[model samples]
Target: MSLIRHAETSAPNIFHGAESDVGLSEWGHKQAGLLADHLASRGAEAVYCSALRRAVASATPIAHALGQSPVVIPELHERKIGPLSGRTRDEGWGVYEESKRRWIAGEVEFSHPGGESFADIDRRVRPILDDLSKRHKGGRFLVVVHGIVIRVALTSLLADRTPADFDAIAIDFASINDLVHDGSRWRAEALNLVVAPSPARPVA
Candidate 1:
């Protein structure tokens, strides 16, 4: 069996996207180190991350600790939110709600003005997952990615989950959700783990 977890990288300066692809915010950097320390303690190997800078940066320290470079997986990139990509969550209310409704209604092909639907991402991410499961059988892997991408991928891997499930799965910053692929089936190990803040760095 292989255990995989969806981990959200810490703060990355609020939707800067292509412009902010260089690295993390101050808090994000600290969070990444903390995540590394935590994963190192857990003895994790075969780390994976989105090619996007934030995710790569987040995975780096941990990969270094494990003596491996985080594998850059483009298929693990965040959902293409299109016109909504660069906007703050507050500014994208109308489009967000509408898209949520479409997803909830099972309209898989529904897309935003110039973006992708959950269906498109599910298609792109599935093959990568299938391959990972086969290649990394009986191991543990760390997958650091974006919020929506994590949710949609989880839904795709689990049986009978739909876009509505997306509404319920919350992926917070530096949070970890675990799943296990036992060759025959994939099972949820844990979901949405909020790491207790280290005493050395009080959360601001």
Candidate 2:
């Protein structure tokens, strides 16, 4: 059997918490439960999460459903946003237009004020991917991590896209992306997918 790689964006996090232990917000809790149900339905054998609370909480319900405790990997943690970690989108440099342009241009070399560049994130996540391949061959795994990390991983694996193309891969909170690892290569199976929202409102 081929290895199924399910990667998820962690729940929405509050911009609070000290440098070491930021956690999920109230909305994140709700998102985590929904994501749990989503991942549970896929029936992964091993549930893995980043060291952050948001990722851990996001993976918890699914882990329970599978009767396994989540395996936490610090390497899976979100890319460090540096001093911008708790700042609002506008408060950060390259907030709106320029950032998007840079991203689409495949430039991962530029750094944020106190944070890292896309290349930095790629470096951190690459080793993790290698480890997963070696340790979990022919198995299904769910990785609960962050948006930037997803982008970096995709940038590394995609056949026709540069890091800049990652700008268009919008991974919402708790959204899931799918991939597969054959013996030697990794392939993306799908991009961001949201669970269909219940139809209780707007109709055509």
Candidate 3:
């Protein structure tokens, strides 16, 4: 299965958490189109996305390219940022970073004020991914989600890896990461694969 991060938003630097419903920016739409073109021939049998607008929009083009409708799963939404929802990095990053630090240091119970903890994300996300993997056991599918969701899910899916191990791995917008299920386990195939579009062409 291919796990994809949603394309950029209008305010790319802002913390648009699970409660925020922002859609794609102009460049984000172009990126989404490019992603669609890149995956059109990959023979994906289904497409899934978080219930958030950005994720839904990102999945639309790919789903169209594959001739399948996207299935929106609310449980796949990004970690709830709570009070940090619309704050820019400069305004609220400290609290967010500290929470992540605590999570990586084995403090899974720590959360930003009103936000979800690492354990909260793991509890809700893993079962859904497991079920989806089972449903598409012998086939490929697409799942459009957020960067943090991808990171948290990876930590849980891979036994050897931990949240700290993936701290340096950047999950860019519209990037594709592949996961393979071998009947009993899931493993990462490729990660952070990006498809850049031509600079001269304008997206209409």
How high is the CA lDDT of each candidate model?
0.69, 0.63, 0.87
Q: Which of candidates 2 and 3 reaches a greater lDDT?
A: 3
lDDT by residue for model 1 (1-204), tens:
222233332433244332335456566667777777777877665888888887887788878988889888877777776676666667876787787788878887787777778888889877887887777777677788777777777777866566778788877667777888765666677776756332235655
State residue 161's C-alpha deviation in candidate 2, in Å.
2.6
Q: Which is the winner by lDDT between candidate 1 and candidate 2?
A: 1
What TM-score goes with each of the models? 0.85, 0.79, 0.94
Clashes of 2: 1
Model 3, C-alpha of 105: deviation from truth (Å):
0.8
Order of models, best lDDT first: 3, 1, 2
True-structure RMSD for candidate 3 = 2.2
Best by TM-score: 3
Which has the better lDDT: candidate 1, or candidate 3?
A: 3
lDDT of 3 at 97: 83
